[model samples]
Target: MKFDKAAGENTLFDNAEFVGRPTHRIDGPLKVTGTAPYAYERHDVVEGQLYGYPLGSAISHGLIVSMDAEAARNAPGVRAVVTTLEIDPLEKGMNNVARLFGGAEVQHYHQAIAVVVADSFEQARAAASLIEVEYEKGDPADYDLGAAFERLQGSGEMDTDTGDVEAAFSSAAALLDEMYHTPSQSHMAMEPHASIVDWSDGDQMTVWTSNQMINWNHGSLATTFGLDEDKIRVESPYIGGGFGGKLWLRADAVLAALGSRAAGAPVKLALPRPFIMNNTTHRSETVQRIRLAAGEDGKLTGIWHEAASHALPDGRGEDATAQTPFFYASDSIRAKHHIVTMSLPESADMRAPGEAAGLMALEVAMDEMAEKLGMDPVEFRKVNDTQVNPSNPEQEFSDRNFVECLDRGAEAFRWTDRNTAPGATRDGQWLVGHGVAGAYRGALVLPSGSRALLEGGKLVIETDMTDIGTGSYTILAQTAAETMGLTLDDVEMRMGNSAYPVSSGSGGQFGAASSSAGVYAACMALRERIAEQLGVEEAEFRDGRVIAGDTDRALSELEGQIDAVDSIEWGDFQSEYQMATFGAHFVEVGVHAGTGETRVRRMLAVCDSGRILNPITARSQVIGGMTMAVGAALSEDMALDSGRGMFANHDLAGYEVAVHADIPEQEVIFIDTLDPVASPLKAKGVGELGVCGVAAAVANAVYNATGVRVREYPVTLDKLIGGLPAIG
Candidate 1:
């Protein structure tokens, strides 16, 4: 049962001193001591900044008959009131999936129609309520995903089929077909999208905002405001959390810029907690059908996953079936995408996107097949291990450790002690169960670059990748320090600024790998520069300096000679091999005997991503993802009021999240491995790994515990009350 290989077995990154070592976040002191300035927290940047408050629509789907801003403008401290009809089109944001409000048409409830600028935040918010608008309300379809989703002409490179799934299932010896629904989920990132915008000296603009992708905004905001990209600069070094929400332009960022331009002064805007749910983006709910065809031996012969999600009228599908085609090998496989147009809030990327929701159904199906075949779920998946993408048989995995991940995880959890029977293991009033699901995430690489400055014998790393509390600063520094053989204190790292070199921009779990690779490239450039400074006839490295035939001086001594090249830049690494992160998530849970609430008892994850730049921070990313999946699987769902087309449970008090009582002790392991294909440092993304399969494992465990299969999300106790067997 012990599947952990020796320390040197398969690891690519764990062998290095700095790679596996546990290091505290380099920005920890500044953040904990309140020195790190967030977007709305910076005071010296703009002295006369006004607060902007957005007025959301009351009607979900409607044409505005009239908007009266008289009362709003008359309110205390209200300076300027801009409504959708009043604001003319500067332009649209290129990367924005949602059409931001303007021109008198309500797409969804709480769509921003007006921004009330006032001297204080509270004053602006109070005045926002005074703006009245007449609407010719139209019928809204919110809870009706089944009907609205059929309109999708379904276009994308996403759909494919190897062999006919209908034919395979019809002839298969065993089959499991089921439907699963995941509800709309809010990112609920602690930092509720805030921004401060100020323009200066005729054409130049500077903004501070809470966002994970800085380069993206540089272009999107410039286009949205009809300005040159070079004139607009954004900076935000410390972000609370994004969970994939801050990857694109949110309302605060846009509204602040518009308000600032109109008021002829800086403006500050942060969506009210009540308005955050509807104003910004959230993950779309998915109704996925998973059909599995297996032989008598429990080996899957065919896998079919079809998912349809509701999106705002102008939006694209959530693409929830992205990972289904390649997850496991099968003779026949098909994955389909369907988008349904609706008048609901815009659906944007959440952590793990397609894979997270898809696995909630697929993993549970694998578990069900294990139940039907009377085989251990772990054993069942291993039996059908696939090395190549079933949909594209031509492309094989560069490295797939999922099989070993499950083997090692099962050994660590003592999974053999688990019984396949429902209502089997119990501790007095508590029912005990263990369930696990394999985790699969595609490796993705994005174009990124970083700038390095070697001055005063210190290495400075600069990239525009926003940290978002992900320890990006610490990891990038570690990578630089490793390459240069410098100590942590000797390396200074700066990030989250448009002025810095463009980065991959911190989403899709690609920030760590992509940004660090850029840093690695910069460091290599520095080594070459140092060699030139030392006048080294042949390439040579020595004690923070270079030597030309034993004639070397301290790197600091070359400061006077290196006027033309104090800082070096590097780019154009996109043509390299595809960089991707991979991992496995395992979960265990308990269902309350009478209440039916599912609680995660413990969790384990094994990641085989190449060299981890910072083990401590990477594991933190993994655990954070698991925490989110825990809520998504059990208690998190945005309640939609169909008649109004608005999220009813608007406040934090009503929306349940996983607290300390909900989270169990979690263990993570990294199979020491490096991919030369990735980059010189050879690392992979771990941000979204913990999110991938944690939910389905818990849901599958609840089934193993109580024998109830409730597919609609939030697995509330009421849904399980009637299904629980009579207790002793």
Candidate 2:
């Protein structure tokens, strides 16, 4: 079935019994009981497996003068020491700029320069320190943001100019011009980057690694080795967490394969916590300027968002202004992005990528403009809302309920009762205030495939989709059970194996909707096969039985089993209409009068992202995103040591993420609506939308409580104390 237009009546999910119901995760028991197998823990995968520890480059940017491994290779249990100098320089992966294994040039600090293989992890780690490397450290390239900003070059990708932005803003009734800065952030996933690799007879190689996209990793490995994809098998049956950090092929996977071949035995490697930060990709820091021009009635006339970000000399900068064109209503708008070349590690996507950082600036500007206009922020947003795309007026949204989200969220949050005056509401030494912001994330789907089989009174589904602790196993199980008319226990799901058909993987919030739709198509085909086997033209299947005009028989009565495979053929829905997830975020924060420390007291989110597949998992995704956004607003920053051109605090103890104590109880509400244009499931993505505008709401609440507006991120006390009003 192809999705060409908006869904009308008689859709497959119109009366879904199991799709919308709340359900517990199917893999929860295995994870909590410590029976689940992670990549590094797969001891049974290969026989006589060895351990490999990586040696990192000491210099941030320079060439390796020499590497001596004689002492390490002759150590107690060391089998092999593979240096970058031993093999030819391999091509980097398509999504990466730094070469993985054999390269003379050091791109950044902690880059894998060599791997020491031994019988045990302890021996490998001890022998790794025996190898010594001398580096010719040149004056490291510019590491200052201010200097990089001065050398910005035009990035032609996300630039847009519609009307005269400067003239319109100059003649507006009210104007807001502000510059916001967001620091680089790291993905603090619990599991480190790990891989286990082994080689078969001559050419066949298998890798058990933690990655988001199986097919992409397979292709990249083939490209690097100059071999056909059939020779490589990538399997990641379970992943602890990705958050876009494991989206592409990393050094651990590549080096493990190389180390195994060099040692003539299977090898396993896991990146240490410090190496994961400075060696792998990170979200680029952004410096953004937002200029909003509005009329006296709180309607927007124009919006101009320009952002500058840094990357490697050959890397693409983060397009931070991509969301401004279609977010709100405006006649004249200009959004531009600039790239500054640096010698830092290559930057890539984080949770929400551009919108996560962009909204932190855009939404706060909206609140500041509302304050100047003396209007409520929610009212201001409602006044400027548009049903159609502001960039292209001919295109209409397939399904948008932003107004409903804001209205329902405000009512539930009791937003009107909040104090209007700054520093008015107080409890003991804390001043309290409430704030709201609009959320938006563009919805998208990639073509995906799956296979289903029914045999021996059980339904089995197979795909390459990954869970990433997002509950993919439970939701996919729900889809198969609902379509096959079977109990939840009667179906099984197999995923994260490259032998299965290719899927959308687990990034961009598209995995659940797209992969489940593919499963639906495959299940439909299996149903047809069952009908053909029963010698009936058509039949209604339910409760493990089939009925066709009084010829009722149990589905298991068939002589043989059936299997089918199919793909979801998505049409040009993206070209004909606009698709996005919309939500409203309300945050209540309290600021200490004496210390100016801020703490979020409560939070609420109302979302409209088409039909929700599972309420329980969807709520979990939203609250997790909200918690990450709190860290972004309050304390998460990858501090850089400018003198050394390296991340100063490059471990979990230094980089702060929101803990349980940092976030309060969060309430999530999903609007009941479906968009047929999205997919057969009529569901859109809600994972990234939960983080888009949440930080700005926290910042807005902080300002309302203390009357101190912080343009920089993390809203720290030093930036607030000077501006705070004196207390009696």
Q: Pick the candidate with the highest lDDT.
A: 2
Candidate 2 local lDDT, residue 169: 86
**Per-model CA lDDT versus the true structure:** 0.77, 0.86
lDDT of 1 by residue, 1-728 (tens): 11112113323234454655789998999889998888888888878989999888888887888988899889999877888888664466855765575777777888878888899988898998888889998874556875544443334544877877778798888888887888988888877889998863467788899988998888888877778988999998889888877887777877787777677889989888867688778888888878899888887788877788878766764777877777777888878878877787888888888888888888888888888888888889899777766776666665667788888888888888885687788876778777888887766766677877878877787788789888988888877777665677878888899988888888887787777767766766777777766667654443565556767666666664231112222233322222345566667778889788677788988887876677789888888888888888889989988778888888777777777778869999888576655544556788887788888888888877888887888888888889875842
255-303 in candidate 2: lDDT tens per residue?
Answer: 8888888888889999988887888888888988888999888889889
| Deviation (Å) of 137 in candidate 1 | 1.9
What TM value does model 1 have? 0.94
How does candidate 2 score on lDDT?
0.86
Give the clashing pairs for model 1.
Answer: 10-672, 11-672, 11-673, 12-672, 12-673, 12-674, 443-580
RMSD of 2: 1.6
How well does each candidate superpose onto the true structure, as a TM-score?
0.94, 0.97
